[model samples]
Every structure is written in C-alpha cells, then in structure tokens.
Target: MPDTSQKAGGRRNAQSRREDQPMYPATLKVAVIHWVMLCAVASTVAQTVDLSGEWRFKKGDDASWRQPDLVDTDWQPISTGSPWEQQGHPDYDGFAWYRRRFTVPTALRDAEAFALTQSLLLSLGRVDDVDETWFNGQRVGGHGTFPPNYAGDWQAHRSYVVPNALVRWGEANVLAVRVYDGSGMGGLLGRRPLLRAATWREVVRLEWEPGLGDGLFTAPRPIAFQATLHNDSPRALSGDLHWSVEDDEGKELSRSTVAVALPAGRATPAVHSFQPSSPGFYKFVATLEPVDGTKLLFSKFTGYLPESIEAPLTREPDFDAFWKETLATLAAVDPQFAVERKIDRDSATHEVYEIAMRSLGGVRVRGWYEKPKTGNRSPVLLRVPGYGQNMRPTGSDAPIAFFSFNVRGHGNSQQDVSGLPADYWIRGLDDKRGYYYQGAYADCVRAVDFLAGRSELDPQRIGVTGGSQGGGLSLATAALDPRISLCAPNIPFLCDWVKYFKASHWPEMDKWIEARPERTWETTLKTMSYFDTLNMADRIRCPVLFSLGVQDPVCPPSTVFSVYNRLGGRKEFRAYPNDAHRVNGAHRAVLNAWIGREFSRPAK
Candidate 1:
C-alpha cells in the first residue's frame, strides 16, 4: 500500500500577514493570537504518536466491524481499489472502506497524558452528500449511518476521539474508515486524508480566519462618495469609470464620469463627491471602459442617498445605444430549434403549454410550462438544472408555470457557439465574451422575461429552485431582479469563488488557473466576485431556503454556511448528514410540501 501519511517536517512554513490586507482594529489581538498558534504548531510533533497512512481499501455493503483488527489479504491498495473511473463504479452510491497502517514515534512515551485524535477529510466533487469515518477498529465520527440510511451532515471534515488505551507507542497501528455517497457526482474527486500530531497549535490554526465579516451599512448622508481604486496588476491600465445614482423607480438621480490611469504595479483611489437632489433608495455604479475600447473589466458599488432632496432624472440618451447594439447582435443569429410542437391544453386541474426556447448559443435548452387549469392564475417555478443536465421538473403535481432552461452550452440551446464535449471544462473558456456563466446569467433573465410575457401568469408570485449550479443561479437571479418571490438552492455552487479554488479539485476549474498561473488565484477570484452569491445575497428581497449535506465532498457545508449567514432576507436552512447532492426521498417531500404551502399563500 502507498504511504499517504504526510511528512512530519515537510509542511510549509506559516504565512505572514500581508501588509495590504484589511484588518478590523478591534480584532487585532485575536489575529495576533492566531499567528502565535500557527508558529507553535509548526514547531512541534507529538512523540509516541502513531500517524495514520499507507492505506488499503475494499468495496463492500456490510459494516459488521467497527475496528478491523484482523488482517484481510483480500483487501487491495486504496489507490488501486475497484470501480475504475470509466465505469463510474458504484454509480456514486454505495460504501467503501480505507485502511492504513502507521508506526508510533518514540518521542513521547507518556501517551496517556496527552490526547490522541484522528481526523479525515473527503472531497466527492460537484455533488454534496454524507459520510461516515472510522479509525483503527473503532467507530469514530460520521454524519450518516454507520452502515446504511445515514442522515447526512454534509461537512468536509470529520473527526474521531482516540481512546487513550488504543495508543501503542512505537508500534504499527491500523486506521480504517468507511464512506458513503448518496447522490449526484460522488466519489473521491480530490484531495485525501492524512495523519498529523494534534496539539493546541492545530486547534488555534482551525480557529484562525474568523468566518466572514458583517455587512457595514453607512448612515444616510450626502450622496457624495469617494472610491479608492487599487490597480494591483503588473501592467499599466486605462479605463473610464462611469458613475450613476438611481432612485427606487429605477430613475437616475445624479451622475459623474471619470477617466483613470494607473502605472504598472501601483494603486489609485478616485474621489467622487456629488449631492443628490432627490431620493427614495439610491444606487451608485462604476463601470470600467478600457482605452483599447475593449470591455476588459466591469465593476460597480452601490449606496443609498437620503430622500430629503427632490432630485430629477439625469437622462443619458447614449445608454440605450449599448442595449440596441446588444439586441441587434442577438437578433442577427438565428435561434436554433429547441423543441418540436407539442400539445397546449387546459384540463380541470392544470393548464399545460408545450414550450420551446431556441438554444441560440448551440446548447439546446428546453422545458415545459404547466399552470393551474382552474381560472386562478398560477405562480411561476423557474427551475435551474444541475451540472451536465437540463432542468426537468420531477416528482411534483402542483399547478406551476414551469420554465426549465439549459444554460448557454447545454441541451438544445447551443446556438452561436460550437457544441462542447460532455466533459469539456474549458469550452468557451478562452473568450470571456462567450463563457458559460456569461450566457447562463442571460438565460436566467430570458426565462423570467418569457414568464412575465404571459398575461395569465402571476409575475409577482414567481419563484426559482435548483441544486448545485442551478442553486447558484437561483441566488444570482433573485439578487439581480426583485420579481422573484422565493428561492430554494440546494448544495449551491459559485459562492465564494476565491475560497473555492483552494478547496475544490474540479478539473473544469483548472482552465482558470492555467489562464493566469502567476496570480491565477487572486485574479480568478476577483473575476468570480462578479458572480458570487455572497455579494448578491444581500440584494435578494425574497424568502429563501438553503439546504446542505454535511458529508458532502464537493460543495463543503462550511462554504454553504458562509453564504447562508450573509443572506439579508427571510431565510431558513436544513442540513442533511447522510444525504448528498439530491436530498433523500423524505427530505424532498418536506421541500415540496413547504414550497406548496408558501407558493399557495398570497404574496406579502
């Protein structure tokens, strides 16, 4: 078996705090303590501790033993375990065990005085689900059942307390674990488990980087505001920063424009102070227009202006020019046929419309629309599909105007763009103008437009739902438009993009790293911020339901929690330890039941 244990002295040195990094003055003391802890942990290794590694594994359905003290020669090396990649073995549903042997270091013989702990981390990739972990011959900790039907915890980390008596100093120790993936893309997609000496430093390192910061709301003041733009790139950049303030009616209040220049590797903060003549709720936006005339970067920040002044609309006739050009470009391309003619009928209980929207970008996007057959108008349910599939409403009999859409490069909607191989991660990657996410957002808006166009549809009662990528779209759409009344995203993707690159091993994301390898981590993250749900969650005006699987390997529960905590509206969440990407049958029942009740009620 290959030794998977980490080298004791090979760990990277602790990182020093970057000078340019922002810090909350009040938390300086806490930050200092974290640095100290990292230093101490890096300097020590526990003596007489047996670290787990050199693992072997086997596939099975039974969990009869908590501790496998007896050796089974039938077991194969975990690295070569069954269910080869092509078979999609186990179909991402089933059970497997990992066993490793380790020898204790003789440095500390008084093992009983110090606590021994074991921890395992798994990454299933894309899908979120539950898992159960074991150590040596004992049940340690797991979110789901020890053997079957375990409720999911959806957490990336699982730990087990080591019995003091189980420590055999200076001897070989066997560590074993059992993992279960219930749905979606499940399996060991990235990273692996290894052993480390547990100490206070380790505990402190875990505590460092206090989750996310709270939203800071400035007191109502003059509309005048200053923006400090920092150009942290190596090459000189030039752009025009367009600024505008708008009222609640979507009317412009005041506007200013500035052209900016920054030398290579420098910082510049532009100050814009303006007074609004009138206000309800105001927004300030800054858009970058590059010198080469290429739309390289587009960024904006919003704030409110007091309603005391009577501000008039500052009309910019040129604004429509951009929209006109965009619309003209879209009209030039023929919309590819998405679906053939189907039946449109009204029954006693439902009104069904066989609908088809062209996949202008090549990926065919298709779906069905069903409304209440009765005279009463029905709310819309905009369902976003997960990775590799188009949205298709399932297991529901409610009267809903369903608009299921395929993102730009998927399904029947592939129009102007070439068809991407089912597994192409970098498809449409080189050109940001045609990237999957760029068109995906547009698809969401088009879906809304389609629903709103129908006279029988109750636009005010429309809602959105999806899992994984679909869940992410739900949050993004809700933030961009207030028309959505409710949203439910399950194990959503594309939250904190910066953190995702560090935590995930999804092969598709490698294109991002390759495009800008030197500052790929930083640049890709900044680009992702434009699409991050955390930044948009505050803008959402509707109620939301967020679900997570504790044992999920792809979308870590912690990341989901980070976004859920930032939501600024009515919100509720559920965590399943044994479940993965798709919730179990029982949980799905609860979800649909809640939706039926909420959607049926009159809008607030």
Candidate 2:
C-alpha cells in the first residue's frame, strides 16, 4: 500500500484554505472578488483581432517573398483561393504562401507595440503535422524541419518573434504563412489557423457545477493528493465518490472514501489522501458510484516520486547481474536454446554490417547492422522499423549497432511471409494465428539469430528497441528470446488486451471488439499474453528504457506505466506531458541520447 502519512507542506499551502478563514466574505471583499471575476471574464471575451479574412497564397521552391516591385500589381491581392480549397492534390505536397489583410486599430497605435503571431493549433482535430509561420512577409520561429512532417503537432501553439518594423500597428498588415503537411490527412481541414497579436489571453476557464470535475490534481505528498469537484447543474446531486490508487507495477496501494452532496449550480472540492509506499509512478482513479452499484463519472490522475533514503531500493540486482540471472532463468527453462549471438563486421562511415543466424525453424535469417562510429564495441541495438514496404536501416551512427531489420513480412523479405498488408494493424485482427504479431515475432527472433551469426558484434551487447507495434515486437522478442541485452519500447500498443479493448476509443479497435463478441476478453487476453509487452517486460533480463506520452489516446499512458512499474529489472522511464505517440524533435534527441549512454556502458 502507498504511504499517505507524508505531510502536505508548502505546496499545499499555496492554495489550501486557512483554518481561520470565514465561510463567506464581507461586502467589500465580495465586491472586490466580483470585480476581479468580472475582469477575468471580460478579458477572456475581449475583442479578438480576427485575421481570418481574405488572404493570398503562393507556392515556390525558394524562400524568396516576391515583393510588389517585382510583380505587376503593387497593392492588388493575389488569390489561389480555388486551388487551395482542393486539398490532397499532389501539388499540395509542397510549400504554399498564404496572404491575409487586416486593418490595425488606430487607437492602439501608441499602445505597447505587438507583432502578429500565426499558429496552427489542432488541425482538423485529428491529424497533427508540422508547419511554419510568417507575418508581414517576415520569418518567425517554427517547430520541426521545413516541408512535410514539420516535427510539431498542430495541438501545440507555436509563437515566433516578428520584427517590429514589419508591424503596421494601426494600418492594414499582410500576414502570410507557408505550411507543410507530409502524410495522412494533410492541409487545414477543420478550423482556420489562428492569427493573433502577441498580447492575447491565455487562461482557460473551466466551469463546474455538480457531478464531476476535470481530471487534474496536485500531489502534496508521494501518495496523497487533493481534487476539486464542481456541480454545474441547477439541482442538488448526491453520490458516493470511490477513489483507488495503484503504483507503476499495477499494485493497488491505498484508497479513500468521500460522499458528495452538492447544491444546484454550486461547486464542491474533495480531497483524497492515500498512502503510496513505493518510489515510482502511481495512478489514482475516482469514480462516482451509481445508486444501482454501477460505475460512472470516472477520472484518472498520475503522480511520481524520486528515490528516498527511508525506502531502501528494492533488493534487485544491478543491470548486469539482473541480465545474468534472467539468462540463467531462461536457460533453466530450455537449455537447447542458449542465449548468445555474434557480430560479423563493423562499418566505418555508414556503420552498416551483415549478420546471419539460424532461426528456431532452422531457417537462417539475415540482418543489416549499423553501429556507433565512436570506435567502441558497445552494446548492440536491434531495431525493426515495422512492416513498411520500404523498411530501411535507422540510427546509422550511435553508441551501438542500431541494426534495423526488415522482418519477413516487410521490405525485401515480404515474399517469406505473404498475405500481410503493408500496414498490418487494421488487417485480420480477429484471426489469432494470422495476426501481424505472429510473423513479426518470428522476424524478431531472426534478428537476434543474425546478430549471433556475426563474429565482430558482441553477444552480450545486444538490446532491442522500436515504436508502436515494433515496440510490441521488442517486448515479445525479449520475452521469447533472452539474448536481448536491454529493451527500450516507446508508446507500444497491444498490451493488457482486456483493458485496451475496453478503454480504446479508436475506430479500428472498436470494430474489432464489436465483431468478436464471442471472443471473451479473458480468452483474448490469455492469447495476447504471448505478445503483450507488459507481461513480457517482467521476463526481460536487461535494464529497460520506457517512454510514454501523457496525452496519447492511442497507447494511453496508463497502460505504459502499468508495464513500466511491473518490470522486474533495472529500469528508467520518462513521460512527455503534452505530447502524444509521436514526440517532438527535442524529445527524440533526448531518447537518442539515453539510448547512446545505455549502450555505451559495459555489460555487467
């Protein structure tokens, strides 16, 4: 169970109520509070400089902005309005210029000068790619690389500094933006991209009245946190609030009870205090128990803590010792398949090598490798970039042989495993044997075999890493084959099959669940145990590096953390708060750095 006895210190005092505070305030205080609230509302609803008017756009190979001096019309607006509306055209694959004219307020001429900021926030509410911003024909900051797949999510609001000279403070200003959407649903499909002055309101107003509040909390202590409940409706509502807490390992810690009786249109705050005795990530769930004993109004919260002196680290061996024990355990299970591999060659520039290995079926699997150019025979990293028809070697130079393998169902090896789609997730999910995971795992084992066949690569210096379904393969390979030196899986899917089937809101999984009503979750999950990374993570011997995104609806953070805490080996984890499955370039850099460092260390 979690330890909830830790005192709520200065962090709580920042917003907690004082014992001597009055329930209601004096007239003067009330007046001041009302005035403040009114001011806040007014600021939120203040006139927004709508920059969505008629705009001109052009596409070019270079960044040169054609000035009026070079064009026929100096003041006329050049429009590509019709062609721009027809999205998804092959011509839309490149950059385009967008021009919008807005009249500046004359009264605000002398007011603090502000530059126009253009941001693409939440494109079409589904797909997210990268884009750039320009104001008055001047360059501003942007996230990600230029052109398609620009590295930044549409949900993220990017602000770039505009030159003061470019701003027509009180006159009409021309705002142009060059956007690039690489794949999937490209272009601005939903709402228009927003353009605003530098000085704009940022506070978000959340109104709450009676059943449940937003899923946010502040953990004053390791195990205990407080939550606010509000009743927005005009009637009193009564319900039992059930709260439960679980650690990263899916171990239930402590839970507290609370009953709420909120008046109509009034708000109530409930504080949950639980004990989290562990020093890892913890999840808290609050549910409004139905009168008929059903569950409703569910919300989740997560918290973590650094290691403390009082709680001695669990009696787990260090990474090397753990891997040795893991190998020994797996060896005890089946001595016929010893855990060892060999590397053949190490490249100088491209870091490419070749490996040959005999699979369990006695068929040899081939692999291409790329090791860190740092001149060190560091731990090896085996990667399978998924079933794409053009899967290639990734991470050419790092601290390890970032060997990316094209599994049998993908790339040059597709003939070996046929009938699988280039994109396999949506293909034959109902069939247990023919499912993508089946062949994928075989390819993973082959990858390890290829590594073992090599003479230059170290057998004990092998790790596996990948994302999405590839992540699932990493876990399965590590579980079925103990030769993997370390494992790093990022936002992997296909874990905790029961929970995933129930919690996922995606169309693909929803269709699968509905079509297979006869397939009980228990049966499906049992079958999935063979592929579930979380279940397999515990079986992995090497230290694992896990990364998760808090806002990822696809592979929810809860599932990731569930597997992370249960891993019975040396582990390190990081969560990007506002990111989804595909993280930003900066975060990717951090992940690469961590992998480099982990592989650089000598095997224990």
Candidate 3:
C-alpha cells in the first residue's frame, strides 16, 4: 500500500536518501548515492562540484534564454533536481527552461589548473522526456529526439564534455537547460547535476541471473552475479572492484574483491556464483574506486526461494463466503446494457462501440468494445487498465473481439465518486465489505457476464489481459469466474501485501498507516488479506501467460514470483533483466503469439 507513483525528484533528496538519512551524515550523502547508481562509471576526477540547489526557472521556452548575458528578472527559483510539477508548476507541461550561474572555484581559476584537468564535463543526472543543455553561450548537449516526433529517454543519465576553449577561466559561467515532459512527472529527475573532470572513468555494471533465467532462484541453487567494467577514456585502466551480496534487510551475506583491467573502448566482465542457503530477496552491489576517492557503484535485485514459494496464503476462512455473498447481491441487479457507436474511431476491419453496464452497488461502468465486422463469433479480449488510466479501444485490427473496460470510479464510470488514485487504492481500508476494489472487481465480472450474453462473442473463448493494477484485476477475474479461459497479467500489483509494504519504495499505503498508527500491522494486514492477489492465485484454473521486470521497484520480483509459484493451472512466465515496470517489443511479441495460439485453438 505504498505510494509508488510519486514524481521523480532530486535523487539524494528522494525516498531512497530519506530512508538512509538515519544512518549516514549529511557530508557522507554519497553513501546513499552508492546504492542507487546502477551502471554509471564514476569519473577519476578528484575535485568536483555539485549543482543541486535553486535555479532561475520559467515555464515556457525561449531561444534568447540560453545566452549568458540574459537577465532573469521575472523567473522564479526552483530546485534543479526535482520535477517542476512536484514543486509549484503541477499543471504545467511542455517546454521549460532552467538557468544558473556558477564561477570556477577561485582556487581552480588559474589556466594551469584548468590545463591539468584537460577539459571539464557536466553531469546532468537524468532528465524526464527530452532536454537540450547549454553552457556559457554555446549549445553543449542534447538528449532524446526532439519535437514533431518526440521520444524522450526518461531513464538515461546525461553527461557531456564542455569544450576547453570556451572555459571562462576566472569569470562566471552560465548553464541553461530546456526540457519537455509529455506526461506524468516531468523536468530534470535523478541525482544532483554536477561538474566533474573528464578524465579516466571506471564503471561497474552488475546483474544477478538465475540459472533458470526466470528471475527466480531456488535455495541451494547457485545464482550468477555478472559484473562488467568499462574504461571510457582512450587509455588502459585498472582498478580494484569490490562486490557484496546483501539480504533484503541489508545484512551482508558475502563479500569479495576483483582486480579488473580494461583497454580503451573495452569491457571486462567477470562472473561470480553464489548459493543461497535461505529464502528471500537479496541485493548484489559492486563498487569501484577510480583514481578519485569517490566510489562508483552498481546494484541488481534478486530473489531466492524453494521450488515452492513459502509465502503463506494469508486469506481468512470467510474469504470465499464473503465473495460468494457479494456476487449473489450483484446478480440481483439488472444490468441495462447500452451502446453508442463511435464511427470516427471505427475502421474497415472493426467497429468501435462505447458500451456501459450496471455493476455492483448499482454503479455504472463503461468500456470501449471492438469486434471484427465478420458475422462469425470471435474470441473476446477483455482488457482492464493500469491505475487511474481511462480505458480506450486498443485499435488492433487482429481477428479478435476487444473490450477496454473501465470499472466504477474510473473514466465514464466515476458517477458515484471521483477516482483520485491516491485515495482510491486504500478507500475503506478498515472494513472488507466497504472496500473500493470489491466494486471494481465486481465490475470486471459484470463485463464477463455482458460478454457471455452477446450473440457475436464466444463465451468459451473469453480471455483477460492487463498490466499493473489491471494485471491484478485479470487474476482476480479469472480466479473468481470460470468463464475466463485465458489470462495474461504483466507486472501485477496487489500481491503479497504484507511483504510488499516492507520491500517496495511506494509510500502511499504508509500514509494510511501513519494516520492510524494505533492500528496494529496485524489488523491492517488482516483487512488486506481479503484483497491480496496472492490469495487468489490458486483459484485460477485457466492457462496463464505472465511477464515481469526484474528491476521493477513498484512490484518487486519476489512478490510476483510468489504468485507465479502458487498458480494451480498451466502457466508460463517471462522475465527481463534490468527492466522496470514496462516490457520491450520482444516481450510483447511473445504475449501476442501466446494470445494468438489461445484464440486459434479448437474450442472444447
């Protein structure tokens, strides 16, 4: 129940840093930085300056703003590392500019001192969407393709070399940044931007791969920890790389060091194998110290368990009885089905209909339905969406019927109450019967009923698919209703609630717990047991195709793997290394192929 959707802000000032504050001093803030850096090699430069505080900020972009002499009399002050939305410009999107002035340290202002460093480089951490950066009066760097056909690399850290000839040895230098955020959180997000020496760099890249390649490791089975070091400079580099494996609670399980050497433009990877004696998730971290005192670090999260997950099914004995009663109450209500055709959204291959249905508690749920114009009945694809997202037709011209359904309090179904996601997930937490998702889950079942009643659809071939919250809903629907024959839930939420509260970085659920500190963890978890997807995994008998990212912080791999291990039906899973919440094209291809095979199979 943690709030995982918080906007990306200053890395050192973000959740990770706050969590480490109790252990490290302000001067040793770099200790926390060591844990967050994944593959970036730390530069050898010993002397560097951090650029993380207030800067002149403006909402819109201007060409002249990049000029060094431009005065920002009206521009407001904002942090360089936090998103603008999280600050004061919550509603503002599109282009924005950030400007700041800093003079070379008076001690390093000498030309000889500058010559020793050769050329200076600027590290801009990571920017959301797209960005163009300027130093003094010249354009220095740009990341992500810009405008017209814009695609921002939200995860990349920007590091650019500043030309030596343009160095203002003794005078003040100005840095300007232009940014564009398409959706959600925007602006410069990541570690503090800094000025560093562009000398020899040492980077440590680490990955923990299970022998099964499934992102889940069995106890007593050896897991490979692969580490690679890259030398960015055009010279040979050598250093001592130290690595350690730690439990989820931060206890070091194993530690060792390796001497690594890399020629120019070369990478040296070393594999270290370790066998876990216990079950749980562990963090593998590698640290490399270049010539500088600063430590470069990289880490990967891995889980180890028995062939069977030890996660207990923490459901109440009344769980089935409670759901059966709710369904009975829902069945008594008559769903008045109505459809509105969206001609503009329709194509020659398929017709789009905006359909509405009456669900539990008499709430109206809405969905966009698409079916092949062919008269023959086709398999149906019921898609539930991620948290707070409105459902829209997928518009795939494949030979199948599709329904993008929105549950109560979502999209057009928000008649009874607005589904502000932050509030929706934990609504009515104290009581099981009044929980919000009870209605949401009922809406999904009603959607299946609606599909069963349709003459143009095959009830036997009904399938459910979704990601994140939708993925959890897919499992719930398939477990509760036997009508669902196929299920594909990607990076599902709502699994292992008690364990999730401790393993994830999300803090939303913590807010409710903080407000009611009087409520014991046991009581809170008991209420959550009725809704935990881990409790529902065993009830699903349909064939399932599940996918997840190993580095997903929102839905940790341990929790997802627990659900995977508990499935009582035929199931296949795909896992990606170093990926977060989203899946790549190859994973999508696998999912599409799986769905195609299921749809083309002979009906029972």
Candidate 4:
C-alpha cells in the first residue's frame, strides 16, 4: 500500500486544508476610517487617493532612477493595470524601473481622524517576480528578494505603509519602483492601485463558516452560512449586516438584511437561513455597513447534499447509438496489439514493455506497460495524460501493473494529429463523428481491450485514473467499458459543457465558433452534448473517488460539480479549497493507498 504517513494521516476521505496557499486579497480598499456621521461607524474617517495611471517606465534598472526630480524625457509610458510585457516589452525580461508623480492631499493633515493615525497605506495591487518601491527617494516597501536569490511569487499582493511624516502633502511627490523578473510575464498588475488611509481589516475582522461542520446540508434543513463580526474598537457600533446567497453561476438566490448592534470589543454572530432545493455549490457574500458607509465584505463557498443535486441528461436521442456505432467501427479494424520487452529499463521487481495498438479510425496509440516479476496475475491500473501531455513510465515500486497510455496528438501517439492542443479542440467541431475526442475516447477503449486480453493481467481487477483532460478520459473510458473496476478522477474536464463555458474560457472554443460562418452556439453545444460527462455518468456503476481544486480555473469547481452531483452509486469527493488545477501531496498519498486497497478487494 502507498505510505499514509505523508499527510491527511492517510485517511480515506480527508478533505485536506491548504491554508498556507496564497490567495490574492482584494486590494481595492475604500477609506478605512472613523466617520463624522449622523449615525455611527468607525472613529476614524479614511479618505483615499487613486494613484493608478500611466507611469514612466524603463527596461533597465538604475540607482539614479529613484530621484524625485529626474528628467525622464525618453522613458516609455506604461499603465499600472497590466504587466509590462503586454504593453510594449513582450519579449523583454530582467530589471525594470517605473516612476510616477502625485500629491497626497494636504487637507488630510487637518482632518480630525488624521491625528489618530501615523501612516498612509499604499496599495499596489500585485507585482510579478519581485518589486521594490520608493516614495520621494526613500525606500518604502517591496515583496520578494532580488537576484541572485531571484525568489518571488507573482500571486501575492503588494501593499506598503508610509510614515505620516514622509508625506509632502499638497506638493508634487515622486514614487518609483524597481522590478526584476527572472522569466515569463512580469510587472505591476491586477487590481487598481490606490493610496488609502487604511484597510477594513485594520479595525473590524470578519470570518465565515457553514452551519454543518462538513458543509453538507440536507435540503430544506434551514442551514446558515454564518459570519462572526468582531468589533475591534473600544466603543460600541451599529450597522445592518446584509447577506446574499449566490448559485454556482453567480445568480443571486436569496438576500437578507439584519440590523446588528455590537457592544464594545465583542464579536457578534451574523446568520441567515438559506434553503437550497437541490444539491450543488453556492457562495455566501456578507457586507456589514453602518450609516457612515464603512463596509467590510467577505465571502465563502459551500454545498448541499452533492449527490442529491439533479442535473438532467442533456444527451441527444442518438447518444447511445452514436457511441455503439463508433465502437462498432473501432471493432471493424484489427487492433494489431503488440508489445516489446525493454530489458535495460526493467527494475528488479518488475519488467517493462513498450506497447502500441490500432485504435478507432486506424489511429495508432502507444503506451508503456509494466508487470511485477512475481509470476502471478496482477491488477493493472491505466494512467492517462492531461491535455497535450505525453506519457512516461512511472517509477513506482508497487506490485500492481501500470499502463501509461497516450492518445493521438499527445506524446509518441501522434500519428495523424498535426498542429497541437489548440488545434485539437477545434478540429471537426461541425460534426460529432469527426471530432478529435471521438477517436481519442476510442483509443482509451482499445487500450482496455488490449489489457483484458493479456494473460498476465486480471481483467476483472482493472482501474483507471488521471487528472485534468486525462480525468475526463478516465470517466469516458469507464462509462463505455465495464472492464474498469475502479475510477478516480481529479480536477477533471469534459463534464457539463454549458456551465463549463460560463465558468472558464478556452481561446480554442472562441476560435472554433468564429471560424465557422454557419455554426451557431446552439449547434456547437449539440456536438458537445455527445461527449459531456454528465450525460454518461449513469453508465458507470463502479465506485468513483473524485477530487477538485476550488481555485482551479482551467477545469473549475463548478464544472466538476455539474457532473459530480449527478453521479449515482458509491462515490465521494475531496475539495482542496486553496489549490489551483492540481492535486496536493497529501491527497496523492491517500489515493495511493485507496487505489491499492480497491484493487486488492474481491471483484463482483
């Protein structure tokens, strides 16, 4: 069995929390202030000045660039809203400098609340690679270390606090930034930058939690997506807590406003009941605002009984007939399955073979097959590849057999597919019969056929698992062929196409629609209906273990849920709230042991 000591304590159904993962905090902070109000808010009123605009830029770094009054006659103009690469230096990298001039209103020095604080907050959105900033020729703040260390996370937000004494109020002041990018797109980017008094977090703090500890609420049970609002100030405050529940597509399902009175220095619980008629993911957004207009906002995601969420089949009437005919066509061609031993790569415990066979439309696919040298029949696991990815033999020392298969257009299996990934998605979009995945799915079926025919493998104990596009392929393969005894998919694609389009964008999808003069979106979706995983979920009766990253944009959590909620029989899912399009090391250990245990069980 795979080692369980890595993480999640190797628990079979652990939803591991990756709290350390960085999330891009909303940098657009309105005045975090105490307000002079007819009602009440904070004791300080925060005024903000937007500093996001065109800035003088240079490709190379120089210590002299930080001067407040340098004649930057030849420096190019660049906007802070986007990376420098997108402006004019698409291929340029390394050190760069950005400078701009602005005034911090002198009137702020006379404001009643201004005397309460000693610093002004500069919100710089996000910077790629690394950045160092200077306000009026003095080092202020920066994130990441410059080379030879060369370490910086592009995702982190950039915020600097400037001492109140440094401000040359109502006078022209220069702000300069030094940036270094090792490679890829780089520069100041993301949200609009601003110079504000403070952020809402500096005063009051807000946090959300589901009513049920596991966040799975039964239908009509009156569940609450509750929030704890803490009043950090010594004085009391009053406000209306507005709560809204949104569906997976961002459609507002319900809203409520409750007046809250906070006692001095105490945390108050804000809650509202939301009843979901069906199972699916939902988001809760809360805004606590007083009459003075100081607002603190926070959001959290949760789901109901996921398996009970109903998504009706959007398949065409000929869905079964279409696949039946495709398989028949594949059956007409001889597989010509062949395997050759690789003596040099064989481990002490197993032997390896380079395998290939003819699949649908006579497209030849390739894979690596390895078996233990115990001279006993072994349960084989089929591992598929992600989009445009090739397959390499895994170096695992497990006793089970492994068949790493690559479809046409991926890795060594590309015999007919030209171009690359973008071309593959749009190819033959007008006709379902000619679509690339039609043959690719058939290629997976042929691999299973080859496995069942092998004497050294137990056909009844076969399993399939993959991530991203491969995750979708595993679902399709298991649905079409019963030989797969266990199925595990992670951050999967090819499910729920209609919602998929709404949640994520693939340029190839746009290109396909634009190139064809007669093809409308309705017609295009009809073709996709034939391949959507939700329509085929009921066909696979085997137990399924699925995982998804809540932050994954490529194959979003919504797309995973559209199909996952419809899955019947034995199934469970683990969501990594902070991950994006990839599985964690802890989940990997869990899968290893789970798969090992599943394969070793008695097959029905």
Q: Rate the local accuracy (lDDT) of all candidates.
A: 0.50, 0.49, 0.73, 0.74
Q: Is candidate 1 or candidate 3 better by lDDT?
A: 3
How many Å off is the CA of 211 in candidate 1? 19
What is candidate 2's lDDT per residue for 1-604, written digit by digit as tens? 1000001110001122211111111332455599989966953554335444345555554465433222323433433212343433432445555556666554433333222112111111111235555566555545457643245353354544343455566776655555654432233322333433333111110122211121222333543355565543333556788777765445577767778675544557776666555433455667765423434554444434322202111222343353344334433332132222333333343355544443323333445556455664545677655324233444233334556566655544544454243446535455544555655676577677657655657888777866655566777787768888778776666665545554454444445556766755455454455456655556777777776665455566666666665677888766665455543334444556766666667777
Order the candidates by TM-score, highest first: 3, 4, 2, 1
Q: What is the lDDT of residue 493 in candidate 1?
A: 76
When sorted by lDDT, best at the front, the candidate numbers are 4, 3, 1, 2
Model 1's TM-score against the true structure? 0.45
Write candidate 1's Cα lDDT for 1-604 as tens digits. 1000010011101122211111221233355689989955753542323232235656664565346575756776543112222223433455666566666555543432243222121212211235555555665455544335455433344544343355565687666655554432233322333444443212111111100111111345453444555443234667677776654234566667778886643556655554545322334556656533534332222223211222222223442353244335544545543333334333344445545554325334556555555557777788776555544322133556566565655454455443345432344444434556656765675567667777878888888877777778898888766788989887787675544544445544564467665646545554455556766667788889887654444565545655776777888876653444454333554566667777878877
Q: Which tens-of-lDDT digit does each residue in 1-604 have in candidate 4? A: 6321111111111112221121111110111122225112332245667777778999887999999989886999988867676688865679999898888897666554444334566778777769999998888778777988666555567877666657898998888999986655578874467776644444466755663544545556756667788664445778888889887677899988889888755789877778886666677888788624567677776766655655567899899999999999999989998899998768666688989899988888999887778989988888887776666565456777888788887777877665253356567878999898898899999999999999989989888988788889999999999889989887888888888887655555676688768988899999989998988888888888888876566676767877877767688788765456765434665677788888878988
Name model 2 segments beyond 4 Å from true.
Answer: 1-172, 175-348, 351-368, 371-379, 386-390, 418-436, 505-518
**What TM-score, over all chains together, does every model reach?**
0.45, 0.51, 0.69, 0.62
Model 3 over residues 370-469: C-alpha lDDT tens digits? 8788878988989886666566665566678888888877667787757654366678878888888888888999999999999999989999987788
Candidate No. with top TM-score: 3
Among these predictions, the greatest lDDT belongs to 4
Question: Which wins on TM-score, candidate 1 or candidate 2?
Answer: 2
